[model samples]
Target: MAENGALLRVENLVKSFDGLRAVNNCTLEVRKGCLTGLIGPNGAGKTTLFNLITGFLKPTSGRIHFNGERIDGLPPHLTFRKGIVRTFQVPRELKSMTVLENLMLVPSDQAGERIWNPWLFGFRVSRQERQIYDKALQILEFVDLQHLRDEYASSLSSGQKKLLELARTLMCDPQLILLDEPGAGVNPALMKRLVERLELLCHELGITFFVIEHDMDLITRLCNPVIVMSNGEVIAEGSPEEIKGDERVLEAYLGGQYLAGT
Candidate 1:
């Protein structure tokens, strides 16, 4: 809905911590339905930028627009309601809850959540809860977590937890998902499944993804028109092959080894 066909856009955005500028006059866009990659070295402000976009951190200046509406400085819950959702690098699962329960908790304002409604409108509340439960089961099946629906989140492996995180986001029916270091701590076998699921979500389900990852191989395989950030600024935007051959990108992050492989 944004002008120029960008689903989300940041203009001259800045975030400062004391005297340090973590994100300095940065700007970018995530086109609708694209699997966009954001790659940068440590201290390059990639996470800081995500924090700003998701309303976890307030920007000091500039503007953020989602679907053609200004959303800078909105609270995290407000952003979530606007169909922008984000996942942490380390999955934030409720360890004591069952996988199904974890997914069920994501949708806001269920009729059964109100005490009076549950007591006065018992039939309505029961029906609403059944609907939510059915949707949670379908999402678990999509992410291959249906088999663990009754298992406590604490019992799952690191990779499964990551999958659980993705399943939880689906409950919100988000328009765009910001994934931070999704490949981190995931084994190669699990990583392949994750990639396939992400692809299906983007292509088949019309969900857009903006991902930050350190794994070049994963970025190369999954993303198009990759965005490179260095010192809190985007220096290049290109295809996987173009990014690999870029001299500035090589010097700033990718380096000679990446070029050699290319």
Candidate 2:
């Protein structure tokens, strides 16, 4: 059902704000079942491109295809129903809700959500609620946040909140997940665990990922055929080894920090 084995494709994508092109004639693809990485220096239009793909922003001109269907102008909720979900650089959890509740809220159009349906179909509503609760618990366990399930999301540390964000995405049963800076503020220990879970999701669960991060270490560890963006267009795509040795990549953004890390 995929086009050229690609789950998502963007062709000649462009977005401009008051004549300032934030994403200029960009083109890329996220192949099915691969953990793809998107990297660039600050202001390379990574986040802006994500906004366009996820339907937070409409493109000035371009085509976006998912599962071979044109979906360039769908709203966020509609795009989500197409099984593409995204997480933010800053985790957006409900501060007043427990971690479990946060995951429970992700599924769309629950039978229990309608007041009259819940009253009329009490048994069905209860059964669905129980199933959702169990699934939420399993996801929390996978992200190593099961112990914190009952705690308010506000009580979680920065790393734990990231884990919670990922768990919420899983509840949507997504095929392609765009992660924006999953390693941004996470501690090294938590980051390792998060990486392990992401790998398992890609390899075992057959989920695909498109990630944006400044952490080259995490990018190299988890992504292959990395895509580099500069001034709003893709400039390179290759494995981490190839990318590291690429003169263009080094000169564009990896000049100092990447070499220092190595």
Candidate 3:
């Protein structure tokens, strides 16, 4: 049953590509202000499910509701405007742009981009740019990337790029963030910082997160009521402890290992 205060709801969702089901008959609800985890082995349709919910791929059937309103068939940008945003496994920063410039570009409301802005509104654009700059710097400091603010995004380390992506997402003032393997390829030292920042975002900013991760340690530490998928459908959902001990989950992970390496 969908909770009354649920922030996201999916009912009997289905998606197919070339007559092959990528996500099959899925139904779930993400409660308001909760950190939820979606986990599975490789090719488990985890990313496919995320793409469906975020509007990267349209569902073949079923319904999606966000904040009690139907949002199926909406484009990705419209979904983003509705306070839903997603991060990629690899950070998508402009290599040539400075870190601050990258963050400054995340917010979509740009007055100067309009054709009439230059002639009709000179100082307004300047004021808005200054305000955006200030906010971008504040976000940089928040992510502990202030020292690298002026550096080319390409020059930063992989972990720093991930942080920059998170900073850019924050610029949108999102209500829900769908994270795709946030800790993947990050170093241990910076990975800790990433975890801390996510926790703070949930606790302080009241943002909801639905994360897809392979790192069981990260999932155990940060997520609750974890949802597991395999073969294009949800297999199980429970707390970290329960999931760890689940026979089906063990089979999903260890069964192949036993056959391949034994």
Count the clashes in each prediction.
0, 0, 0
The lDDT values for all models are 0.90, 0.90, 0.87
Per-residue lDDT tens digits of candidate 3, residues 1-262?
Answer: 2358789998999999898888889988888788999988888888888888889999999999999889887889989999999988878899999999999888586898787897889999999889889999999998899999999999999888888888998998999999989888888888898889999999888999999988888888899989888888888899988877777877888663521321
Residue 188 displacement in candidate 2 (angstroms): 1.4
Models ranked on lDDT: 2, 1, 3
Residues 1-262 of candidate 2 have per-residue lDDT tens digits of: 4568999999999999998888999989999999999998889899999999999999999999999999898989999999999998888899999999999988587898887997799999999999999999999999999999889999999888888888999997899999999998899999999999999999999999999988889998999979998888888899988877778877787464653564
Clashes of 1: 0
Clashing pairs in 3: none
The alpha-carbon RMSD values of the candidates against the true structure, listed in the order shown, are: 1.4, 1.2, 2.8
Which wins on TM-score, candidate 1 or candidate 2? 2
Model 1 alpha-carbon miss at residue 207, Å: 0.6
Model 2: residues with Cα > 4 Å off, grouped in runs: 254-260
- Model 3 segments more than 4 A misplaced: 256-262
Question: CA shift at 41, candidate 2, in angstroms?
Answer: 0.6
Clashing pairs for predicted structure model 1, backbone only: none
Find the candidate with the highest TM-score and give its number: 2
* Superposition error at 33 for model 1 (Å): 0.9
Q: What lDDT score is found at residue 113 in candidate 1?
A: 84
